[model samples]
Target chain A: MNNYWSAIVNNLDPYVPGEQTKLSNVIKLNTNENPYGPSYKVLDAIKNSCNNQLRLYPDPESISLRDQIASLYNLNIDNIFVGNGSDEVLAQSFLAFFQKEKPIIFPDITYSFYKTYCQLFNIAYKTIPLDEYFNIKISDYLPKIHKNYIGGIIFPNPNAPTGINLELTDVEKIISSNKNIVVVIDEAYVDFGSTSAVSLINKYDNLLIVQTFSKSRSLAGLRIGFAIGNKNLINGLIRVKNSFNSYPVDKLASIGAIAAFQDIDYFNFTCNSIIKLRNNLINDMINLGFEVLPSKANFIFAKHNKYDAKIIYEKLKDNNILVRHFNKDRINQYLRISIGIEEHLSQLIYILNKIVNN
Target chain B: MNNYWSAIVNNLDPYVPGEQTKLSNVIKLNTNENPYGPSYKVLDAIKNSCNNQLRLYPDPESISLRDQIASLYNLNIDNIFVGNGSDEVLAQSFLAFFQKEKPIIFPDITYSFYKTYCQLFNIAYKTIPLDEYFNIKISDYLPKIHKNYIGGIIFPNPNAPTGINLELTDVEKIISSNKNIVVVIDEAYVDFGSTSAVSLINKYDNLLIVQTFSKSRSLAGLRIGFAIGNKNLINGLIRVKNSFNSYPVDKLASIGAIAAFQDIDYFNFTCNSIIKLRNNLINDMINLGFEVLPSKANFIFAKHNKYDAKIIYEKLKDNNILVRHFNKDRINQYLRISIGIEEHLSQLIYILNKIVNN
Candidate 1:
């Protein structure tokens, strides 16, 4: 509210990230982080990079790391754009391709940051509501559904909070219909079970797929994320990035993420473990009379038949367990629980059974 | 050139940072990186942080690192704002404070990124030409100098490339006269030899001081920087940062920076060594019949009286050495050479002597 602030600052509705509590021994299943640590190889690589060469600036282009990501996706380095994190990459995308004379569109109940970005960039937006079953309807995004123009479209595959993944076919339909505009597929949780939209990149020049090392790769602390898109689309992001921060990815982060991409066995093992744990947790919640969404992410969205969602969330917190409960419309009774280790989930289910019965 | 890019992207002339060549055995002094590495303690802290905890997201507010920086300046945590690098901080500052009714003003030949930011944010600006001696004249920044409106002011102290430090009293005079507008003093190279405007934070709420770990603290590869200012201005930056990237500083970066701030003795020793080396290098350049600016930074800006600046730059590159040369209108003749180790400088002088004589 300072007078010195720009008018945009006063209007900015900043994004509130999930709680990152530092309390020790808490079952922290709130942020959907991977239960397992990143590959031990990543640690070794980071440790090896901690040398005198740190006196110099990291590569502004992050060429080697981009090359690694390119190899994984069978894309060229020019198709990739890396940043401090996926959040930063998203911000750049909004400025790069979304702002226009017409408003952009997304799921009404998708990642809240999309709306926040709209406010920050003064881009007009309309949120099309999800279907009654909490699924993204490709029909809702058809151009004929709206009379006014649409500048772009963006939604997370295997969406957050609900964790329901839209099939790859629907993703392509949206991209094809929005050929005149940029269609961003935010695949932050894609590695758990959902298919990637990256395969369609060559077919649709306007398709941009953004992913992160935070979820399946388990490198949230290193803060690495990237976008895979057409070379021209990537160049647009690069222009905005070069205008902003020349070196968004630091040396250690680049090295750590490169190692994460290199260890295919470890990556597959960890993602499979999370998917297995997620299924087990879903089954346990269903047995306790909770109705759960069909989740493709590492987290589950569920509501109890008897107990109040907020009360259950509090009880879990009181018992030194943490899960996310969004106090928002149409989803107030649902709790988003991230999958933890087998032992932690066992304790969670045991505690939930007592809370629900009582 | 893409139609999808935001209208601002087309007008943006992005800043071209010095080349980060991958060539080996080159005496790299192009960027003002410290000749020495970060303290051993910093490396140890970073290595220790490479563990399982990296599975979780870093603290979005970066409380611990902010505390360390606040303690260094005898200020509160509310007065400090940390970001990916000084460049990011500078970019945030442009969006947060400078996009006002009137055009902001800076030196025509200052850090070129300032102009790039003005273009990126679509903020109007006027660049006051430096005096014939290449020093930032405080009078030109005085409110009376321009009949039209002035939005704000930002300039690098020990101004970039030229490396001439403006007196603290002059900095205060500009800040005082421009009380209606925010004044930013970028002190990226302040630790080398110049006094910090941090001493003046309490005196003026509109004064914001930006500093970085790249040059003096020897952590360019780590990408840590901070801004010290009034609580309200800091709040403004927080709003913009939260809207953009909630956690610009990653986990390992935060821990590594805290360690760098803790080892004050190492910081001072490295800074003093660079200052001593800079003085010797200046004297050597003067002996070689080159005119050098009165530098107060880790880099020296010099031009030979007879030799063409671009040829010298290329010759040095050919000799397995790298230095910066801007081909802009005013400073085209100057070669900005970073202060490297004694051996690197001796070789520089020997080669320059031969290049000039031969």
Candidate 2:
């Protein structure tokens, strides 16, 4: 810790993202990326955009892309706000709407980045524990808001690591009841299984739904994500954004993301494939003596009753397979594995059977 | 003025970038964009990068691009920090090093974004007014650093809107005298003319020089920039960056930036052309009865005593030519014109001659 650093900088415990290992043969599944490629149209659009026009800056407002997103969601242009990624959009939201006299609230076991953001922005936060069955209790969150003031709320629809989704009715109840506080729904994996909160955006002015091309749309490396909310909330974020970085989405990202939205058919097909593979993977794991969570995301959280998770994780690593194993208490027994292609799943099942039987 | 918004959000006056008009025929000379395209190799690299691999997230560390920049600058990898753009890099720098008991200092007549950033980060600042000739007085800056009170210093080299560069010797003197406070030399337009402080990074640990691909490398649309400094300064930026956004640069941007570095010959050729054109354009403006600054950048700052800059700006817009005229009080009389291609400049001169004669 250097004395020259800011007080906030010293206090930050930055989130460590998954390892981006360059190994050619490793069975990679840690980061829950779609195994399928982005649409051919996205690549074509990116190639077309690589011209002398790149000498100029991209549209600071990203108007055309926002229009396309608005059209897809049946919302007005004022409802949309885009950024470098959903991470950036979320970061801006925390700065714009989450910092207040009161503490923000979220699930105790949710996206780890929410806590990281709180540390960065110095936003006070309280994590309400989920139920004994690892389900989010809307009742628990509702009463806490009355007891202690809440600035905002955020939880992934089909939550990460656990991969279980809260029903849409439950989400609507929480959002409608908490009209005074901003409610952010991160739909990074919504396209895989659960319904999007975008339809509810018109009804709930305080509701802000954040989505990313990184997951179901398969454009993680392009760095594009956006939020749909009421015009007032979008304007608030745009103000913070314009103050921070005028042009967050680069030209290539803008063109590619717009094209990704245009190719709706391709998006649906790819997400359907992932959902089908997810079900098959779950069955295979259960047959191999592993207990799997009811997953709505692209990845599964599971643990074998007989074998130690850390040991199993190490054994898989030795065989050139990579999966995420959290060492934190209460969740150390489970490993989060992303759904890969059919061939990758077959290989994973083969390896797991060998290890479990031994 | 929503009640749910952050208190700081309501107080912000966001920076307004120069207009990027979508009109095609306008001789765009507002932002200091390179008059030529990036190297063919750069485009090719981006094309090659836009593949199925986009499914996975880019390297959060961006090690390959960092190593490429480090090799080009003859510095260790630890001395380099890359970001979405120099704007983002500067924003991070303000958060990382520009906070202390004392106020940060900058020229009164300089990049307006400096003040905007100060406001965004809530950084206390004291403006050191430029002299009558619009030159920063090093003496005024040096005397104020007693008691180790100044948090940091930042100014554009060949300062924007004036285009007069601080001598490298003078910069070294300041760096030597102010070893305790961080001194940032923003070299966004350094590649067009003048020497760089990057060579002195090893000798002065307190110096951090920021540069951008937007001006000289013609990658504004790609949104890439970097900072060169001592390891300690770079490490501080990395900590803030990781907490903020892990993957600021996308796949295509990284590949294109690396390729731009590789094609040194192409880079030199394009920059030389812009320099030659800039000299010619400045000479022509003086001949047409204009008071021009001694420019050491890709643009020139000039004013015609006979013509109100705003009126002239409006007339130029009518003639399908666009130039920047700041509404700020001090710089209101001036028109900041970016050096464009030879054909574009010839047409602009022709239009100016007609306007002046009439």
What docking tier does model 2 reach? high
Reference-based lDDT, residue A49, model 1: 91
Task: Give per-residue CA lDDT, model 1, range A100-150, as digits (tens).
Answer: 889999998889999988988889999989988899988878787854388
User: How many Å off is the CA of B235 in candidate 2?
Assistant: 1.3
Displacement of residue B214 (Cα, Å) in model 2 is 0.8
For each prediction in turn, the share of the native Cα contacts (below 8 Å between chains A and B) that it retains comes to 0.84, 0.77
Which lDDT tens digits does candidate 1 get at residues B1-358? 7887878887789988888988878999999999999999999999999998999999999999999999989999999999999999999999999989999999988898998898888899999999999988888888678653898999999999899999999999999998889999999999988989999999899999999988888999989899999999999999999999888999998999999999999999999999999999999999998999999999999999998899999999999999999999988999999999999999999999899988
Give the TM-score (vs. native) of candidate 1: 0.99
lDDT tens digits by residue: candidate 2, A1-358: 7766878888888888887889989998889889999999999999999998888999999999999999988899999999999999999999999988898988888888899889888899999887866788888668554564778888889887789998899999989888888999999989888988887998998899999999998999999999999999999999999998899999999999999999999998999999999999999999999999999999999999899999999999898889999887678899999999998889899999999997
Worst 10 residues of 2 chain B by lDDT: B140-149
What's each prediction's TM-score?
Answer: 0.99, 0.98
Docking class of 1: high
Best by lDDT: 1
